[model samples]
Target: MTTQRTETTTLWRPTGPEELALVAASGWRAWPPRLPEQPIFYPVLNEDYAIRIARDWNVPASGVGYVTRFEVETEFLARYPVRRAGGETILELWVPAEELDEFNRHLVGEIQVVREYR
Candidate 1:
């Protein structure tokens, strides 16, 4: 008998201190719910884009920023289309706020803090 390996898609997210705290509170297993004004939970496709956001955008806003890496089951990710928010390399998976809980359920492993900026 052969064992089948599960496919997973790696994703990166740039976040502030507050959000990182919440992620930690979940034991690094899930993301917190989006705020009222926040309509989407977007995880970028590349680490470079995540680094840029963490260093340039998030750090300035919160004094510190973090770049987190995580994996989601590729089959579940198929439901959401990749979105380009800016330049060509700015690719992301846009999971609607309402579907975030379901999205979290598809996470393949714990979210990791790959890099930090201050």
Candidate 2:
């Protein structure tokens, strides 16, 4: 018998450019840990959701925001539940603060900025 390798899928995360800078500082391999006050890392399912957060919340609050795209192993994604918030089209993956390192291990490649709001 043989075990098959799980394929990876793409996901988007919206954050301030400062946060993205932190990711780059890590050598483009993983995300920085969530802030002390942040309990979860929300990686959304669609670009629309990411863009909205970047544009509406991050930009308004910080003057700059970015939408980042990356790939995650499908097998790892099974460990958590996806959640919906704000509206029907808004969906996100809830990565607990403790599980973030494991989540980072599943990232397939560099996290790239797909869009930016300033």
Best by lDDT: 1
Least accurate 10 contiguous residues by lDDT in model 2: 80-89
Expressed as tens digits, the lDDT of each residue in 1-118 for candidate 1 is 9999889999999999999999999999999999999999999999999999999999889999999999999999999999999999999988999999999999988999999999
Residues 1-118 of candidate 2: C-alpha lDDT, one tens digit per residue: 9998769988999998678889999887799898889899899999999999899999999999899999999988988788888798799988988889989999998999899899
On the 0 to 100 scale, the lDDT of residue 101 in model 2 is 92
Residue pair clashes in candidate 1: none
- Candidate 2 clashing pairs? none
TM-score of 2: 0.92
Which parts of model 1 are misplaced by more than 4 Å?
none
Provide the TM-score for each candidate, comma-separated: 0.96, 0.92
